[model samples]
Target: MKPKPPTHITVFAKADGAAPTYWECPSCGFLSGDARFLDTEHPCPECGAVGVERRRFPSDRVRRLDERIRSYQKQGDGEIVVILVMTLLETILEDILDRMMDAHGGDLPLRRMIMDSQRSIGVRIGKLFPALAGEEFEEAAAELGYRDFPKHWRTMREARNAFIHDSPFGGPRERLDARMGEDAMVLLDQAYRLFVLLNNRFVADGHTRS
Candidate 1:
């Protein structure tokens, strides 16, 4: 039987202002922001190809959106920070998953159709990732040493939804506080690392090794 997904809660540490930096393998397009990844002249873990030049992951467009989020955060607009943070996280998730699918030989139109049909974040985590990755999202996260990430992300998503959409039962969340904004920042920092690990493992290594 498959192991159950983790149900434990997560706590966040204070986040710094700087964003994480990641390097990509030009040969296979694997991305990793972990310092350990860039520390030496290791062969590209994906295609086993040595590289001449590498591009930065989380491209310029993404960096600009991250800047906007930081600006909102600095201005103490917690509500907007929470919302835009979710947007940025979702974008990263979509980008990595698309790359994973591409590595698995999915064509563009098919990938777009799949993404369109399963637009909900819940489905993406619970169903879509597993379908491609051959394991639960929670399982993958735990193995990658971020056991609490999925739980914390789910909580933040709940908070974001409460604030963005009216609930027939509870109306809507009045506002997202600075504490929640702080939590969002913590998750934002973790996202780059977690998704990079995932991309490196599943999108690149998983595909190439198999």
Candidate 2:
């Protein structure tokens, strides 16, 4: 069966200050910050579609938080680094899901209500994300060269929970050390690229949003 087209598309406009500019391909949903993409005629790296219209990606808040996390990591604040990196990763996941919803013609209130009903990260990733993206999250991650991302993310989450909750029966299983913090930083870097790939595969197709 044929799919419907996207009802609306997101476009990028010029912004002030040090914030980066982003562009999204109208044809394939490939997004990039390169100035060359803003030109009238450019081939999409993913789909090879010509003269694709590129829209701006609205990610100012996410960018700011990412910068803050990087700054803290440099100071040897392992605890903060681990916690913040997890938060950032989750935030990116949320953003991607939101875009996916938007691609499906889901309104803001509906998206909020649906998301609010499923607050657990495990449910969101294991069930909700796959249902929306039309494939399992782990499969997508693996295809995108992030085969270990899910496991590593889960491990970090366990460490963060252990540190925060300090289980009554077992006590804290382990301390979030510098090594974990370093791992978090690496994941943080990878998350953006992976999310973008996911977006292109699932959300960037113009049919999804329609």
Candidate 3:
């Protein structure tokens, strides 16, 4: 019998204290933080695509923001961390959706019009992303080993909303703590990898356009 695949993958950090290091399979758009997966003979878990070359995500802005968020977290500024991370996550999601729209033949002006109309993250993830990617965002994320991402993201968003807005019902039911802030950080790291995989799948290879 073939040896069992590794259950846990390692995410390596950069020497410059930049973004965490990960690998991308060009052939199948699979993303992995595990260094073992970078071997030339290793096959992509999702598509059986083989390659040794690993690609890095071009995310200078995201990385800079992530560093700042980390600093806030270290200082025990939970509220700031949560707020900033939520904003960052939304921006990243918007970028991915925009790229997906572009791959599906949307021009610059058309893409702007479309995005302007769907400012709600729920609608974007549930309806727009699926319409462009040919799969539900949650399903795609789960397939790529981020099964809890959608739920966690929604929870954080709800918390952020509650904290930001004073409702007559309760005037903000939940308070964001350091734990939640740490969770937000975890999600931030995962988002970069997931979005990169998504871009490679739909945008980089010209799959949707073709």
Q: Which candidate leads in TM-score?
A: 1
Writing each residue's lDDT as its tens digit, candidate 2 over 79-166 gives: 9889988987888788888778877878999999988998889989988887787778998899767999899999899899888886
Each candidate's lDDT (Cα)?
0.78, 0.74, 0.74
* TM-score against native, each model: 0.84, 0.79, 0.73
Task: For model 1, give the 10-residue run with minimal summed lDDT.
Answer: 5-14
lDDT of 3: 0.74
Model 3: per-residue lDDT, tens digit, 22-112? 6766654445666666786776554556655766544667778878988998899999999999999899899888876765667999999
**Candidate 1: global Cα-lDDT?**
0.78
What is the C-alpha lDDT profile of model 1 across 66-92, one tens digit per residue? 988999888988898889989899999
Prediction-by-prediction clash tally: 0, 8, 0
Return the clash pairs for model 1, or none: none
Which ten residues in a row are the worst by lDDT in model 3? 1-10
Q: Which stretches of candidate 2 lie over 4 Å from their true place?
A: 1-22, 26-29, 43-58, 206-210
Candidates 1 and 3 compared by lDDT, better number: 1
